[model samples]
Target: MSDAVLLLAHGTPNTLGEMAEYLDKVTGGRAVPAEVVEELQHRYALIGLRETAGAEPPPLTKWTLAQGQLLGRLFFDNGLKTKVYVAMRNWHPYIADVVAQMRQDGVTRFRAICLAPQNSRTSVGLYRKATLAAAEGMEVEFVAGWAEHPLLIEAFAEKLRTVWKVACDELGKRVPVLFTAHSVPTRTVTGDAPDPYPIEAKRTAALVAECMKAAGLGEQDWRFAFQSQGVSGGPWIGPTVEETLGVLREEGHRGVVIQPVGFLCDHVEILYDIDIAFRQIADEMGLKLWRAESLNDSPLLTRALAELALGPYTAGVEVAPISARV
Candidate 1:
């Protein structure tokens, strides 16, 4: 194929032993403190451990590849011949390696879509930089963000509806919803490099809530907050999931549903951050918490991605591969 569609994501290590190198790459070769590395090793171990010692395997890479394969099939079903590829930003199958493979395969021009739905300097910006910098002789285009796409909103709304029912049945009453997204350094967004990340995150949350409300759901109350605040510090986004849970507890909310609108699939963030860390905190606060499932291998999400890959991208001029069969 001379043209292809690429899916980019924040990759995870296939096993626990690679945490040091993964952290090194993520920090641009900085020497991550031993304590930090050890802490991360412990966190990764909690996700899943092999029968042997000192090994933890994650399913993010597997799920991401499945997403790509499904998207390729969806394109073929619609009479398109575009190929789909997945590249990791911080681990094996790195962007440069995949670009080299594509070049070797005689693929000329390709459109890249970050697996992240919302755009931010800390996330998609770095991804765009790495991808474009890797493709020296190839035509490259990107779907920077699709936070408010109807299909995407519908996909998330479906998760909410499914989880909301479980929350209601357990709590014996309707509960409030707390929409969330990954927190970035406040400086990057509100400081010098201001971005629409926060706005887009809120827009996604609002759209999902509106979709649910139109379906006669989430009428009790809904609030937006940030999750998985990093150790990079310098004041990340406001009203963290922990803080919000406290507020809900104080407000006498017996239960609350969490919907992470930013992420599209399961990774360390979803696997450990929400499923373990947030859940533990919620239990301590006498609050029941259920996160919306990751959109891994979801047919709706695959269709949404196919739409982006095949849709016309307006960038002062039409982006090539609009036909998706170049």
Candidate 2:
């Protein structure tokens, strides 16, 4: 049987003109306020301006495809006859388009892995539903979460260690490290059968913290927050990064380091949200902020994804449920 690995990601608009369309897809064709679109347009423009200034913001759509190609090469090198396919949930080369291409390629079955490490019905569930709807004739295995995958944890921890010392030295103290993830609506994970997202997300942070201990961070030196919360409505999950930063400042901290444990690659969320918006808040509060780099096209990330694809993955993880994961 011909097999493929379909890598799904939350895609970004390639240009400002596509912002409204992207928002429409994200909100399931609901009307997004014009102000919201304008705000997002501004954010996208900032990223573009950063690219023009030569810092080269992470072009998310490109990064998603690059990550898949790396995974495809890794599979080839490991002697697995699995081709990798890139599908964006919100943009071009969408789930349906990619499934049609796979059909044309004569692939008989495929495994779908959402690029999201921590799962929530809010995001990952939607991706699963869409993929299943598209790939009607193919056998699909969905990896809902891989939060505690050792290599994945290692990738995040490695990122923290790279900047841990500088963040401390720059401020003349061991600043608190804020581990963060994208926030979802409160009801999505708290009502009914609670989604395991918050639990798994914490474990991912704890595991990464444990890895940082080898580099001299303390047990209490780190905490968690949710960032990039939607402005769409209702109470989203919290303590938000802003609130957490406020608490850190009140505790007499002069600085903080932010490591977004949930995201694998740089997108607007990391680029615009953490790097731009969060930094503005931190600066206003006189709390120096350091952001850990995203693991874009990291070989370790590919290894983690590969293990998830070719499982029976049952060990070397700290807090992930082995067999019960969705």
Candidate 3:
């Protein structure tokens, strides 16, 4: 495809009944237990029940589709005639199926990027596999792992500063900042090479903290944590956001700001994990809580992501050839 961009993100179930199938794919065909299934169903129910201004809960798939449209507009405005498509790993528009459709459209070569900024064998690595598997004869290039892009950092930093100001104005005190990302299994990220997921998450957090300092706040006011750990009976990464919350409370910080820099859009992890679950804990702890909004196809994020799609390799970057035919 001379002009195409594929945007990928973690897929969510369209309905509660689809949870088992989604989890099955996510867990590599493992049979989820009844209790685990029930818990997932509960979360999906809560996700579907969410509302804003009396409207219905927003579906992640719909939001992702809208993001693709926005990205297409950005690419067009930037003088690149790229057709953008959104595909999910476990949802309706599966990566492989989407690639098949793209081939029918006469597209030959294209660049792709996952919604996850940080590359990990567990996350972006999976996306790369699916993308390559689907491309029958197309030359596929992926712009993966854009964790430290200045514009991307600026986007989150701006949200952080905005939310921090809101909290301080309402509460009459500066709230500590806690940066969070989805916690992966320790086994997947540990070992000699070590996964860079946490490191990338912290890098974004540190940059946001630096921006906050420029806007007037001490370094000690900010820290990082992980969230949305799986319910699987395995050791996952820590210190989790829940643990960090207790620590902040013990340290006498009565209010806090959450910046989930790892996630680029508002999905179950953000809508429920932070907005509902974490808020419940904060209520019990008597702490005012604020979460920075996800970037979500905003102009800043679009510009940053668009630049990745149109790449010059950033010097010393070597992209491996995908599963393609000559």
TM-score, every prediction: 0.92, 0.92, 0.91
Q: Give me the overall lDDT of model 2.
A: 0.84
Tens digit of per-residue lDDT, candidate 2, span 61-97: 7688888888888777756687899998998889999
lDDT of 2 at 141: 76
Better of 1 and 3 by lDDT: 1
How many clashes does each candidate structure show, in the order listed? 0, 0, 2
Candidate 2 versus truth, CA RMSD in Å, comes to: 4.1
Please report, in order, the local distance difference test score of every candidate based on alpha carbons. Answer: 0.83, 0.84, 0.80
Badly placed stretches (over 4 Å) of model 3 are: 49-58, 315-326
Off by over 4 Å in 1: 49-57, 218-220, 314-326
lDDT per residue for candidate 1 within 53-150, as digits (tens), equals 44323677878889999988877877778899999999879999999999998888999999988888888999999999999889998888888877
lDDT of 1: 0.83
By lDDT, the candidates rank as: 2, 1, 3
Q: Which ranges in model 2 have alpha carbons more than 4 Å from their true place?
A: 49-58, 313-326
Candidate 3 backbone overlaps, count: 2
Q: Indicate which candidate wins on lDDT.
A: 2
